[model samples]
Target: MNKILLSVLLIFCGTSVFSQDTLLTILEEELEREFKVLSKAEVPVYYMDYRVEDETALTITSSFGSLMDESNARMRVLQPTLRVGNYKLDNTRELANYYGGGYFGANQAQYLPINNNSKAIKQVLWRVTDFAYNNAKERFQEVKNSDIKNEIDDFSKEKPTKYYEPPALGSLDESYWKNTAKKLSAQFLGDSKIISGTVTISGSFSRKYFVSSEGASVVQNFNFIQVFVSGEVVNEDGEIASLYNSYTASNEKGLPSFDTLMAETKSLVENLQKLKEAPFAEPYTGPAILHPRVSAVFFHEIFGHRIEGHRLKSEQDGQTFKEKVGSQILPDFISIYSDPTLKNVEGIELSGNYKVDDQGIESRRVEIVKNGKLQNFLMSRSPIEQFSNSNGHGRSQIGADPVARQSNLIIETTSNISDDKLRKQLIEECKKQNKPYGYYFEDVTGGFTQTSRYATNAFNIMPTLVYRVYADGRPDELVKGVDLIGTPLAMFAEIMQAGKSIDVFNGICGAESGNIPVSAVAPAILVRRIETQKKPIVDIKAEEPILASPLLNKKN
Candidate 1:
C-alpha cells in the first residue's frame, strides 16, 4: 500500500545522493566498502543494513468454471541487517541467559540479481554480508560470555534515514484477472450443495532497495490487489463448512466493482449454503456482539500480540502489557491506535500502509490504548521498559528480522452506540446474564494468540460468521462450530458497548517476523461476558467426493 507519495517520494532524491540509482549505486558502494573491512573485526560490527526486495507478481485461480491457475512472477529478495555488539549491547539481544546463541546464523532471503547487475548486485551483497558478519561474530561471542547481566538496550539509537522512491512499475490485466476468475468461479456452479468453489486473483509489486552502515538511503513502492472468494460445504453433520471473502486494493482502481465482486460472490455462495445448514455451536458463556469485521479479528488476536515492544524483553514472552503502562487497558470508552501512516480508513484499503519501516524507520502513529490507559508500546529498534525508539512498527517478511509488528490497528469507540443500539445491548446483556442466547461475531478468518511463556494466555477467534441473539424475542439464529475463546484480560474486561459503524480487516500477519501485511479497524462491540469453545472435529472422511461434480452432473 505505498505506490508513491511520501511527500512525492521524498522529493525525488538526496539521502547522500543515492548515486543516481544503479541499485543505489551498488548498494552504497558495497555499504562503504563493507564498513571499512567490518570496522576492523573482533566483535566490531556496530550495525549495518541492506534490504532489497523488488518482487512483482500476478496470479489467478478459479474452480467451478475451470482455469485452475495462472501466474507470472519476478524476484530479488536479499535482507542482510547485521549488528554485532553496540547500540547498548547487540547480537540482536534477547538471548536470555544464552540458550545456544542463534541470532540468524543462517540469515535468509538471499537471492538477488533480478538484473541491475552492478557486478551481479555486489556479488549477492558480498555473500550475504559475509554470512551476516559471521552470524554477528558468533552471536557476539555468546553475548560476551554471558554470565547474564542485562539492563535493556540491545539496539535503539536511531537517526539514519534518507528516503527516495523512483523505480516504480505495476501493471496487471493478465487477461483481466483471467476473466475475473472465470466470472467469480461461475457463481459456484449454481450450488448443487457446492463443495468447493474458488476464485483467487492476486497482484503484488514491491521495490524497496534501502542501504546503510548507518547512513540509511531508502526507496519504497508497494502495491497490492486481492480478491478472493471461497466456498466449501458438507453439512448433514459430517460437518465441514467453509466460507471466505477478501478484497484489498491499492490499485486496479482500488478494486471493488465487478458488480462489487459479483455481489460478494453471491454473498459467498449464500454463506456457503447457510454454513451447510447451521446449528452446531454449544459451549457458550454469555452476551456478545462483535462484528466490525469480528471486532477487527478481535483486536488483532486479542489486543495485538500484547503490545509488541519486542514482547517486553522476552523471557519467553506473555508480557501482557508489561505492568500495564498507565493501567486501565480498556473501557474508559476504549481507544487503541496503531496507524502505519494510515493509507485509507473510511474507504478501506490498508494492508498496513507502509512508507518506510522494515527498519529505515519513517512510519508512525502508535498510541496503543488511550482513554483506557495503558498508552504506548509498538516500538521496534527493540528496547523496552519505557520504550526507546521506533514508532515505525519495524515489521518483516522476506526473510524475517524486524519485529514490533501490528500496523493499521485503529479501534477507538468513545462510547458510541447504535447498530440498533449494539443489538439492543446484546439483548440487554442476555437479559442481565440469565443468558438464553447472545453471540453474534459475524465474519472472521483470522485468529491466533498465545503470547508465549509456552502458550495459553488464550485467544482463538476463527469465526466465519456466527449468530444467536434471542432472549425470548426469537429469530437471528445461524450458528456453527463455536470457537471465539478468550482471555486478554478476560476479553478486555467485557467491553460492554461500541457500534456506530466502522470496519475493515485486510490480511496476512504471521509473526516472529514472517508473514507481513496487516490492518484492523473496529466498531461493533457489546461484550459483557463472551467465551465459547467446541470446534475441533477434523477427519474429512478422507476428503469425501466420491464423484458428482462434472458441474454437478445429472448428465451435465
Candidate 2:
C-alpha cells in the first residue's frame, strides 16, 4: 500500500508542474524537440517557427432594428512553419554540389484535432514537425538524383542578427471607440444636416508569441482603431452623391477629435455640392503641381511599388530602377525614404508603427533615393541576388504570407520654394511650352500601377479634385474627367521642384496578399511635364429622381 501511494504522489506532482507551465515556456520546449529531431535527421539547413496569436476585437455596425450593433469577439491561432534544405547522403562532390542549392518550400496548416485548450497548441506543433521532416526526406532524395552541384552550394549562406523584440501594447479603450462613433453620428445629423447615415467603429488588440528552433523567442503586442463614416446626398440634378471618411490609428490619443471629424464631414458635404457643378476636363499634356495629398498617391503608385525587392526578381516586372543605380531618378532637391520605425509625424501617430516585422526581423529605414540618386530597394527575408536580408519592411495580414511592403514614406525637398511660387513657376513653364493652362491636382481618391515588364510599364493616378492654372493669369478652373498617366522613369525625370510646407496622408494600401495601413508624408511637388488621358464618362439620359425617405423629406 505504501509503495503504491508513493508512486501515485510522484505522478500527480509531475502532472501539476507540466500543467502550470506558462504558454511561453511550453512553446520553448516544443522548439527544443524540433531542434533535436533536425539534428537526428542530419538536415543540412532547417528553420522552424512556432507562434500563438491571441486576438480581441470589438466591432460596431449599422443595422435597421438597432441603430448600432456592438459585439466583442476573441480568437486564438497557433501557427507552426518549417523549412529544410541541402541534405546529402554521400561524400561525392557531385552529390554534395546538388544538395547545396536552396530548397523551395510551402506552408502547411497544422490542425489541432483536440479541443481548444493550451495543450492543443502542442499538438499543432507536433503536426508541423512531422510534416516537415517527411517532406525534407523526400526532397533530399530528389536533389541527389538531379546532380545539380553548383546550385546546392549557394544555399548554405546564413545571414545574421536581424531579429527584433515586439512592440509594447498601446492604450485601447472600448468605451472610447463606441463613444466616438456615437458622437460623430450625432454631429453629422445635427450640424452637417446629413439626413441618413451609418458609422462603424472597431478596435483590435493582438498579442503574438513566437519561438524558433534557432534560439529566438519574442513576444509582440499591437492595437489599432478604425472609424468609418459614410453619407449620401441628393443634389439638384437628382443625382446622389456619396462621401466617405475613414480614420485609423495605432494609439487612441492620435485619433482626431470628434469636433474636428464633424467639421471635416461638414466640409465634405459642401464639396459634394460643388462637385455637382464641376465640369469634366479635356485631356491635356502640360506642367502640373500635385498637392501633398495627391503627391502621396503619385509616389505610392508610381515609385514605391516598383522598388519592392520581390518584384525585381520576377521576370514580368519592369525593374525600372535596376539599371539606374548610379544615375539620377528624381530632381536633385528631392529625397525619399520608407521607414517603419517612425510612429508619428508632426504630433500625429502613424498607423505603420510596429516593433518587429512579420518575419521576426527588426524594422529599419530603407532610403530608396537620396538627392535624386537611386539608392536601395525595400527588402524582406526572401533574398534577391543584390539584396540579401530584410530591412524590417516584411509585412502581411493575418494568415497571409509576409512580403516586402512599404511603411511610412517620407518625401523631403531641399528647395525653399513656397506653394505659390511653385504654382507660378508651373504657369511660366506652361507659357514657355505654349500651353494655355497647367493642372493643379488638389486631392486624390486612389490609384494603381503596372510593374510588369511585359506591359507598357505605366501607372494611372486618379484625381478626385483638379483645377487648371491658366498661364495668362486667368481664374482657376475646376474640372474632372482626367487621369494622370505616365511611366515611372519619365515621370521621375520631369520633377521640377518641391514645396516648402509638408502634408501627411494616412490610409490603407491593398496588394496581392491583403490590405495594410500606411502613411505618406510629402510636400507639394511640381513636375515640369506629365501626361494625362481623359477618363471614360457615362452618357446617361435624364431619369426620374429617387426621392428621399418620407421622414427626411418632411423634415427638409
Over the full model, what C-alpha lDDT does candidate 2 score relative to the true structure?
A: 0.68
Worst 10 residues of 2 by lDDT: 1-10
Q: Pick the candidate with the highest TM-score.
A: 2
Q: Sum up the clashes in candidate 2.
A: 8
TM-score, every prediction? 0.38, 0.81
Model 2, C-alpha of 6: deviation from truth (Å): 52
Error of 1 at 11 (Å): 43
Q: Give one digit per residue, the lDDT tens place, for model 1 in 1-556.
A: 1111122125554444556677878888888899888877776787788888888888889888789888888998888887877888877665765342224443556878788889988988888889878877887777777765568777777777677877676777888788878988888886666768888888888788777787777888888878888888777656777888888887888888788889888888888888788888889888888889889888888788888778777787778889878889788988888988889987778899887888887887867778899877887887776676777788888787887889899988778787887787788778887888798888878889887766678889888779898988989898888888878998888787888888998999897677888989898888888889998889653245577657557686
lDDT of 2 at 41: 65
Compared to the true structure, candidate 1 yields what TM-score? Answer: 0.38
Where's the lowest-lDDT run of ten residues in candidate 1?
1-10
Residue by residue across 1-556, what tens digits does model 2's lDDT show? 0110000011223433433436666777878876776755665436666666667788886522124788877776666656555312311112333232223343444434323355777777777767766765666566556645232122212232223233455545666556666755554443222344667877777776666665555566778888777665443444444456777787667678877877876676566556657776787888999998889889988988888876665545677877776678888888999988898888866777776666566677778888989788887665555565567776766555567788898889898589889988998999999999999998877888987766788999887678899988889987766889998888887888888888777778887535877888888989888888887544642344366444445466
For candidate 2, list the clashing residue pairs, or say none: 97-149, 98-148, 98-149, 100-152, 100-153, 101-151, 101-152, 316-453
RMSD of 2: 9.6
